[model samples]
Target: MTETAHPAVSAEQAGIEQALTDQVVASFDGTPDPRLRQLMQALTRHLHAFIREVRLTEEEWNTAIEFLTAAGHITDDRRQEFILLSDVLGASMQTIAVNNEAVPGAERAATEATVFGPFFVDDAPEIPIGGDIAGGAHGQPCWVEGTVTDTRGNPIPGARIEVWEADDEGFYDVQYTDGRVAGRAHLYSDEEGRYAFWGLTPTPYPIPHDGPVGKMLAATNRSPVRASHLHFMVTAPGLRTLVTHIFVQGDPQIEIGDSVFGVKDSLIKDFDVQHAGTPTPDGRALGGDWARTRFDIVLAPAGA
Candidate 1:
């Protein structure tokens, strides 16, 4: 007895891909929306081309599937591994660049925006307007005070500034052995647009290296880290909000080689130590004196 011939696996792949393309085109064939049509067509072309360019073998494709599974496995309420994956690839910044492009002098009558790092802890303890975010401990003893202004150069009273920064040890409050949430704080701008908070200069540090994101960085031999920075989002109703970081200028990582690609010259600032005798805010002691840096932020109108 003899067996009949069976269809080759390669032939099956070719047929399925062609069928998939035909279906996609047929579904969009009479779409009258120009923008929608353009997006769909461009996506199809790039996706199909990508498959061809990579000559993606079934084994390689399976590996990709498994990688995604692992990625999901590493994510939960406190950590988002996929976002970390995107950060290392620079895709997150590119997306922001396209969406919130600061238009010269018209940069939104709101504060600037920056990356929402994977470290924000939900439900951070609410503290008084001038309370110490440094949690009664000490590092660089920085008095960060500033004003929120609009594009037309007017003050935006009542704007809220949510700020978070790692300690001098390069670890955030959430990462402390005490398992506490204190380094983060929310302060509302007072009339005349003044907002002040007491804290330490955040030190430059590395991103998490316990997952696939770490493996990706290692394979490329590129460091996974960021410069010293304080993350902030200054928001006011009817104004464009800014999600950005204030960089400590002394950190070499903020130069052209920032591992996370987050440094902007406009956002870089010097946090010099002030050794003269300056009084610490109510109820706190400065030992001798403390460090201070004044940063003023301007916001643009929502549509600007």
Candidate 2:
């Protein structure tokens, strides 16, 4: 008696896709959830199709691997280089826009969602209205006054609008390296649904480029700067959350050339500075005859 042993169906160059698909599908048993099974099957088909369509080379794939690895290694406790990767590529904003399908006439969602950078310190002081948020001894005097209201045109009492931004020197609290939390405040709307604060007019600032994000920019011959804007995160009971920024009008740094694709016509606001001798938002003392500005914000409802 004689027996024959066959080399188990080897994947020849003629059938690369079938070989790849078979290997991928064989790993998942036939009893997995139908949705998961469908997703994996679709992913496998598209991925293999892409490889065949592009005729990808090993070198290209390896380079992508290295890129993802480097991006991973660059992220840390305070800095998220991966998020930056998604940001500069506009993936972050795109995802937000896709998920935020507000009704057609729903107050236009108040404002557009912008990038949430890496440096937000929690639990800012809930100071009184017209109180100052800027750390003492930094930035010019800009009185930021505004009412916080829901999409229904009603005020949002107790709504906390967390405020933060870089200093006039283009540095944030966490960037000091001296361990400080300046120029950041957490303010709650008063009973009238109003919030006011005094601070310096924000300036266009560059992202930390001595890091991975910086490396990515240099590698791509792109800039590492963001348009000048004050950051805000508004939260109220039963209200839709808002992540936004008020772009300074007429800032040369914020042209069509914003490196991260974060600029929008709607987000840009006027930073009208009231010179020394001009009345303040509340007729308070213009300490040392300083500058003043205002930015009123509108919020969208949770259902909106």
**TM-scores vs. true structure, each candidate:** 0.83, 0.82
Per-residue lDDT tens digits of candidate 1, residues 1-304? 1111123436666667667665775677677997888788667756665665566789988987887888899898667889888888888888877778665755433444667788887666555566678774446778888888887778889898888888776777765567777678887888898888887877778887788888878988988778888888778998777888888877778764766777777788888776756666555666665777778998767766
lDDT of 2 by residue, 1-304 (tens): 0111123423465365566566786666584598888778777767766666566789989977887887787777767777787888887778767755564675534767777777777776666778787776377777787788765667778888898888988888877767676788887888888878887788877887876667778998998888887889988877778887788889887764676677777888887766677777677776555654455666766766
Winning candidate number (lDDT): 1
Clashes of 2: 1
Off by over 4 Å in 2: 1-15, 18-56, 107-109, 283-291
Question: What lDDT score is found at residue 85 in candidate 1?
Answer: 84
Backbone collisions counted per model: 14, 1
TM-score of predicted structure 2: 0.82
lDDT of 2 at 45: 66
